[model samples]
Target: MEWAEFTEQSHKGRASWTAIQPENKRTATDNALALKEFFQRFPEYQNRKFYITGSFTSESYGGVYVPTLTNLVIKMIQNGTLPNVKLVGMAVGNGELSADQQTNSAVDLLYYRGMLGMQQFDSLKSCCVDNYDQPLTYCNFSQFVVVDDFGNLSPNNNTNDPKAIQCGKLITSFAMDSVWATANDVYNSYQDCYNFTSLSSGGLKGEAGRRTWKAIMGSKRLRASVQQSQDLQSMFSTGSNPFVDQGALYNQGSTDAMGGFACYMDSATQVYLNLPQVRKALHIPDSLPPWVDCNIPVNSQYYHQQNHDMTPVFQSIIDSGYHLNMLIYNGDVDMACNFLGDEWFMENLAGSVYKFNLLSDRFAWNYTRGSFLPQLGGYVKSWSNYNTTSIDLLTVKGAGHFVPTDRPGPALQMIYNFMHTGNYNNSVPFSLDPQPLLPQFAAPPKPSFTRKQADRVWSLPGVTYELNFKQYSGYLNGVPGNYLHYW
Candidate 1:
């Protein structure tokens, strides 16, 4: 299924295209209709139950679209328009459900992380109080700090003008740093930045290069342009901004689509996807514009006419009487949508929505890696409405914006357990090794590679272990003069 054309187009460009065309509005309902049409075309899968999931901006979209789609499906089923199409539940990671709450918590996270000094933080508290719903001019905190081009922040020693120190540029500086600086990755703070020059000079090659690329790309952060940073500042300036109005917060510019914070493997992925053969294999039409990770034009034209606060939508679903589950997970270190903000949203929902009761105290979930002992994966808190519905809020401890990419093992375990058991519990240890053999069964043959050349390429450096699987690489025909490489 596809989003409205304007929404898709806005994501491709850097500027707002539909700002001039106010009448050209788009919302989740359009996508719901498309999904309904898709189900109609395939009657055989009409009654199948499905779970929805999304990350980042898509997560934000899911908060609105999923419920809308769910209600639409319910109506269809009631009217016999669709025999059946079950909407079991949904999961969202680092979602922007409430912009005001997220922005406020993002600043608070930075302060807690030592990004802000006690004096500066005190000053901010004094000026803006705990609430960030005031005008930008009224709560300017940036004047007290100095932010360099590299995104580094320090106290402004030039002067101590009380008016200047209100609350102006601190968030703006951090926002810019998240986009251009290497030290502050808004996605996964612990991951290394991928240097484009290194890739071009063959610094990353072979299996080692592939591993490095995977690590970098797996934890890659989203990039917003300087203008986008300014837009964020404007968003803070205007209290209670909606995600749609603040395009820069989610939309990716050309450079962002090309790589992301450090140009990670997206550059290569873009090249590979645009390859003539690859596009043809994917059935992409020649007339369509080149594929990009995000389309700025689509973001610019998009509109959410519905209430910005999605609490009502969620409450409506819970009241709908259908058994459902919802999981809102966040990577603790992500500035884009910090865990604190989501925690606040969930807490508010639990208090305001009917039938929800605290089911479990917040507890640590753990995961085991290789031969190492189990480690803290994250923390989880849950609420339930008897046996009919459930909601959970979780945080992946050291991860940033991209939970799965930043902490794949923990993410996989958390998601798997949640999907199967309807809760995030890692009490039982998980293992990768096969189960012990039965007394009657014969032992399997020792794994071995027949080809020496292939073995050499696939061999892990400094490791001594028997393999259960083989690895291979190949080259594919690209756009006439070029070729695509894959492992």
Candidate 2:
């Protein structure tokens, strides 16, 4: 098929695409009814906390996953511009070829070999692993972290996967501002996962180089060959380079009839994976940058300055007699930020260290993973339960860096349990309003001083202490004393 032909085919995309729109365009009257419906369904949210998040909120994956090198390679093969590369062999399996065909396993191996940096090829090949079979581990060497204010995280090793990492960092770090902070709140606690020592002079440069990125970088190149995509079925006379490490090509796994060795993805598949991502890419005509751009019109270089953005706002919310939950969730597949970062954030919350020791409580539910899934999210009750006020780590099952996108069901369920019962329940239809958590932790009355004493201490003009020590802060004219200290 010609590029022009594929372009023409793409025109019909909008006819079938999904579009999410607000009810009645969300006017005051519409929102009033929405409010009415809200109260009708769950009245507690009225003037209470609410949250919505996902890739849509983060604006990650703009362009969806198109323009990706893999996607481009796919398109090139589809157009027949890439020679000797059959586009059809992309996703098709090398499982069991018929008498009439042989497998292009080598090519498939090569593609995954490059795309997945440190991933094991054997595990990757198992991705076509039979049903109920173990598929490849996307990034198996990853670790979980529990550190300072950043909470738990599991960031992807390859920073070059900028689209996935930066965009995730930007969105996860800031997108929930309205829910947690008011007007400019951001908190980024994600950490880099790759080992830095692997790059140094005396590090993995020698022996590890075999598995080190440098070795992989040195020994690979695809020999691009082109043929008319329209005339895809034609058999070429030339065949194998039996001596080469990557054997001669044959159709591997993709559905396209074009018989070249290739990795190709068309535009439609991308939209199906993430339509909103495509929309965002289209919106940013000049630069579909991943993560929040430095020039995001804020602190310029002070971009990931999330701590700066969030700390004061958190204090403000505490001051306003409101409850705030700073939650960080991660999807395991997301090779970007890991849950280790979220662990870091939680441990160091409120500028100090905390720990949630693995509880020996009898396991409550079936935390075991179901078929096709890997690890399920589980939580151990904090040792200091019935403890003091602070945010808690809320884990979701089967999620990735983009937790909401991957496991919105569990996430929403957790938040529902959070705001409603102040607990997380894995069970569906978990009891709502299990128990009211009317916060008894309101701000104490400000400290006071006699009129003359305040005048001497603060030196602010016209100080009048109308109320006594009853309204402690009457001395400072509503200037709140430090809740942790001034008392």
Candidate 3:
């Protein structure tokens, strides 16, 4: 998907790329036009209230696309181009608000979540502090890397230079890969799927090797000299290898494209979607292929045509005085799109789109049980107009990139409160505890292969290393229609 490319470009100031912006915007704009036409054909449906919602830039059309579409609909209704269609509220989660801010926050979040250790953090911090005069939290690591690669930390560094940006991306990719590999150790579960494992001594040795590579990469001279990014890609590649058994663990069902934090949902959803009865009931023909969660074609198109920042679109909507409620929230643990960056994106619009600097002070949103103490659920910072708060920035604790999928209870509660009362702060009352709301029975996936299996031998390319004990490797087709494997 060239995520690294987008990440690098975003870290620079330009945000959206001219190369992809036109096609992406046109795609979304055309869809909005088609939707308006459909509604026009059905006059009876146009009178009812409608609310719009989406997640990530894919569904949200760069996080601002749906709202932009809605705005167009509103304009059409006002000008008699279409029947009146009421769009009362709009919400987006873990979506792109600001490219630079998102990249900055993502790097910072890796540190916050213990993915990037203190050593890496210190290195990046020095690069940022010396070059940008900003803390690591706010600085663009990509730009910092570019300057650091050049042996200069000057404020006036040409971060946007194509060569510099590529250099920065390569270095950033190496550092991020090291951290991501190490992150698997702490999380245990593969980010793509629910396969869980504690690395064997051999795996630990591989991890140690990865660490050594990272330590060696800490040198700017060495880092800049290394021109090949395939090295970073291969570090985490899911190939048939005995030393690194990611192919057996995560690639069996091709579920490695999923996320960590929740296993049951991932497995169970696959089960439900692939059920023949369910598929038939949902109007699927037997001729069609089995159901998959993601649309790879669409994803690829979005990636190729992905460039819009959407922050400006958000500001445009806010400045339009639409009177519609807008909410932007995310899970705190999301490395894909961090909450802090979204907060920064929203806050930056305060003085520009909002008159009188509408953004209010941030506050913690605690979850309290009647007699017991309160748990910090997350944080909230609201943006106000003349006397009313319309924009909300919030976080869900212990959640990853997908908030609802990760912490459904708090997310639903927050949604209910915002929808019913239009008060984000009033959601999740102090008297209500969220512990009971989450799935009480969902357990983490247990590993089929234990560390004790480390001594078992496998026939592979490297050597005829022997196992004193017998070893077997095969896939386990679970009742949930997904595949798992062990070595």
In the range 376-474, model 3's lDDT, one tens digit per residue, is: 768887666754237777787776555675555567667766677655445455434334325655444333444334324455566576657576555
Model 2 lDDT per residue over 1-487, tens place: 2110011111112111223221111221332233345445753433333332212222121111111222343333345443333221111000111100101221222234253233433433332324215544232111111111111122233556544454333222221111112111011112121111112112443122222221121111111123222211211111211233222233333222222212121122333434556656656443543322112122212111112112232234233332223333333222223333333333444335334343333222122222323234445222222232334444444443334433444555554454455455434353322243356833343344344433332233475755333321222233555323221
Ranking by lDDT: 1, 3, 2
Weakest lDDT window of 10 consecutive positions for candidate 3: 219-228
TM-score of candidate 1 on Cα atoms, chains taken together: 0.58
Error of 3 at 42 (Å): 6.3
Tens digits of per-residue lDDT for model 1, 1-487? 1121113422212223434432111333454556577777876666566665643323433454555555555555556765666666677787756544554565566666776666655545544554444422223344455533211334455766654443434444342232223345555554444332221113754333333332342233333222223233222111333335545445342233212433344555667799999999989999998976544344324432243446766766666676878788888876655677778778878756564788887998777666768888889888887767788888887776766655666777787777666545443356544345585653454243333333234566676997778665544456886767666
| Better by lDDT, candidate 2 or 1 | 1
On TM-score, the candidate that comes out on top is 1
Global lDDT of each candidate: 0.54, 0.28, 0.51
How many clashing pairs per prediction, in order? 24, 60, 1
Stretches of candidate 3 above 4 Å error? 1-23, 30-49, 55-62, 125-137, 142-171, 174-261, 269-302, 351-356, 367-375, 387-389, 425-487
Native-vs-model 3 lDDT?
A: 0.51
> Using Cα atoms with residue i matched to residue i, what is each candidate's TM-score against the true structure?
0.58, 0.29, 0.57
